[model samples]
Target: MTATKVAFTDVKWTMLVTLHMRAMDSRQAEPVLGDRFAAEAERRIDYDFGSWRMRVTEGDRHLVTLRAKRLDTWAAEFLAAHPDAVVAHLGCGLDSRWLRLAPPPTVSWFDVDLPEVVALRRELYGDAEGYRMIASSVTDPGWVEHLPTGRPLLVIAEGLLMYLTAPHVAGLLSRLTTRAPAGQVLFDAIAPWVVPTSAMLSPLLGAFRMRWALSDVREVERWGLRHRDTETLLGHHERVPSTLVRSVYGVFARVPPVRDALRAFRFDF
Candidate 1:
C-alpha cells in the first residue's frame, strides 16, 4: 500500500508535531491518552518525522498528552450532561480525537482545519453520520456558521490559541460564545513568560510564533464568558523524566506564577 503524502507547510505542518507526540505516547507500555489511531496515522504517513524525534522531549509529550486527557475528560462530562451537544474542534489537524472519544449519534462533531489539512484527514478517515470536516481557518468568523445551533456547544481548541493574536482569539471566543445557547470552551494556554520561552524552540516551531498569553483566567471572564476552572499540567501527580525534577516541581507548583506558566482553562458562556 502506498503511504499518504503530507505536504503541509508553515503552521499547518505543526499538526504533525502534536500528532507525533500522541503517537509516541500511544507506543508506551502504559500510555496516558492511549490513542492507537494516532500511532497508525504516523505509520501511514509518508513524511519523515526524524527531525522532530529529538525536538519533542519526554516532558513535552507528557504535558501535551496530559492536557489532551484533561480536555477529553471534560468533553465526556459535557456529553453526559448534554447528550445532544455540538462539539467543534478548532484547528483539528490530524488528531483522532473524534475517533478516540466516540460520542453517540446524538452528538454532532465537527473537525475543523485548513483546506490542505482537512483534505488529508478526509483521505485518512472518511465522513461519518454525525461527524463532518470543515476546511477553513478557525480565525475566520464565517466558519462558525457551519456548526448546528440550539444545542449545548463545546469548543475544543487544543494547541491552537497561542498561534492566534489577542484580537483573533477574542473574536473567535465572541463568535463561539454568542452563537451557542450555553456551553464551555476548553483550551490550553501559556503564561506571558512562556510566550518568550518558545524562542528556545525556534527550530521546532519553524515560522510560527506564539502570539497570545494568559496571565490569569479572569482576563477571559472580562470577555463575557464566566470562568469555570483552571488546571496546571505541572501540578498533576504524574511521572516525569527524573525523580529530582518531580520533587522540585512539587515545590514550585505551589507558586502561582510557576503553576500558571502553562494551564488548561474551561469557561462557560
Candidate 2:
C-alpha cells in the first residue's frame, strides 16, 4: 500500500506530533492508551518523524498518551451512561478516537476538524454507519450548530483549546453547551507559563504557540458548564525509564503551580 503524503504545516502540522507520540507509546508493553490505530496511521503516513523522535523525550510521549488515556476514561464513562448520544471530537486531527471508542450505532460520532485534516482522515479512516466528518474549524460555530442535539453530547477537545484564542474557547464552549440538553466536555489546558517556556525551548511547540491558558480550572464553570473534575498531567508514569527522575517529578507534582502546568478538566452542562 502506498503511504499518504501530508501537506499540513504550522498549527495544523502539530497534530502529527501528538500522533507520533501515541504511535510510539502504543509499541510499549504496557501502553497507556494502547492506540494501535495511531501506530498504524503513523506507518501509513509519508512523513519524516526523525526530528520529533530526537526532540521529544520518552516522558513527553508518555504524558501525551496519558492525557488521551484520561480523556478516554472520562468519555467512556460518559458513554456508558448515555449510549444513545452525540459525541463531537473537536479538532479531531488524525487521532483514531472514534475507532478507539467504538460507540454503538445509536451514538452519533462526528470528527470535526479543518478541511485539510479531515481530508487526510477520510483517506485514513472513512466514515461509517454512525460516524461522520465535519470539515470546519472548532472555533467556528456554523458547523457545530447542525450537530444532532437530541441526545446527550460529549465534546472531546484533547489538545485543541490551547491554540485557540481566549474568546474563541469561550465562544466554542458556549455554543456547544447550548446545543445539547445535557452532556460533558473533556479538554486539557496549559498554564500561561507553558506558552513562554515552549517558545524558549522546543522548536516543535514554538511553531504553533499555545495562545490560550487557564490558571484556574474553575474558569470553565464561568463559561457555561459546571466543573466535574480536574486531573494534573504531571507525575511518574510506568513508561518513564528512570526511577529517580520519576521520583523527582512526583515531588514536583505536589506543588500547585507545577501541578497546574498541564491539566485535564471535565465539565458538564
Candidate 3:
C-alpha cells in the first residue's frame, strides 16, 4: 500500500508558495524558522519545489521564512497570556505551525483552510486531542459560529488576506472582535504601491494575485478596530536575521517611504 499524495488545485495551489519556502528554509545552513516537519512532509509529497523558482526567488526565498518567524513569535506571546486560548489559523497550509508552537494542552487549536487543503492536512497529520481541522473558507460567516465563545481568541492569517477582497478582511476583523471577549489578529499584506499594478505583474508574486495592498498598515486602523500594532516586516532593520537579505532589503528600507511596503500587523481588541 502507498500513501496518498496531496492534490490541492485552483486557488488552493497558492498554499504551495509557503510550503516551498519552509522546505527551502529547512535546507538552509542557518534556517530562520527551520520547520523540520516541512522538510519531511515536502519529501512525502511529489510537489516539484525546484521548478517554483519563478515565484520564490533567491531573496523572496528568505523573506517568506522571516514572515513565518515573526508571526510565530506573536502567536507565542498571545498564548502566554491566554494559555487556554482558542486559535484559528486561517488559510492553514501544510506548514506545521500548531505542532511546532506546541501550545499548552489546554489550548484549542483550529487549523482552518479550504476543504481540499483541510482534507490533505487531515490525511498527513491527522488531528490531536485539542486540535481541530476545519474544512471551510475563511470568508464564510458560518465558520465563526463554530468557534467557542467567551475565551481569548487569536486569529492568524498568514499569506491569506491579499488574495481576498478588502470588505472580506474588514468583515472578518469585525466578527472576531465582537465574538471573542479578548482577541488578537495577526496577518501579512503587500504594500499599496505593489498592489494596484506592479506586484500583480511581478514574477516573484507568481500565482498570487494581489487584491488588497496596504503600504501603511495604520490605514487599516480605520477599519474600526479600537487598538492595533503594525511593524515593518520585509525591511532590513526589522527581525530579518539573514545578513544577505538584510543587505539587499536594507537599501529599500533606507528610503523611508518603503518602510512598511510589506508588513505584518497585529490588531488587539
Best by lDDT: 1
Better of 1 and 3 by TM-score: 1
**Candidate 3, lDDT over the whole model:** 0.77
The positional error of residue 109 in candidate 2, measured at the CA in angstroms, is 0.5
Can you write out model 2's per-residue Cα lDDT over 40-96, one digit (the tens) per residue?
Answer: 999999988776533554447767887998899999999999999999899988899
Please give the lDDT score for candidate 1. Answer: 0.85
List CA RMSD, all candidates. 2.2, 2.0, 2.5
**TM-score for each model:** 0.92, 0.92, 0.89
Tens-digit lDDT string for candidate 3 (183-230): 788998887676666445555454566788765546567775544666
What order do you get sorting by TM-score, best first?
2, 1, 3
lDDT of every model, 2 decimals: 0.85, 0.84, 0.77
Error of 3 at 98 (Å): 0.5
Off by over 4 Å in 2: 52-54, 57-59, 201-204, 235-245
Candidate with the larger TM-score of 2 and 3: 2
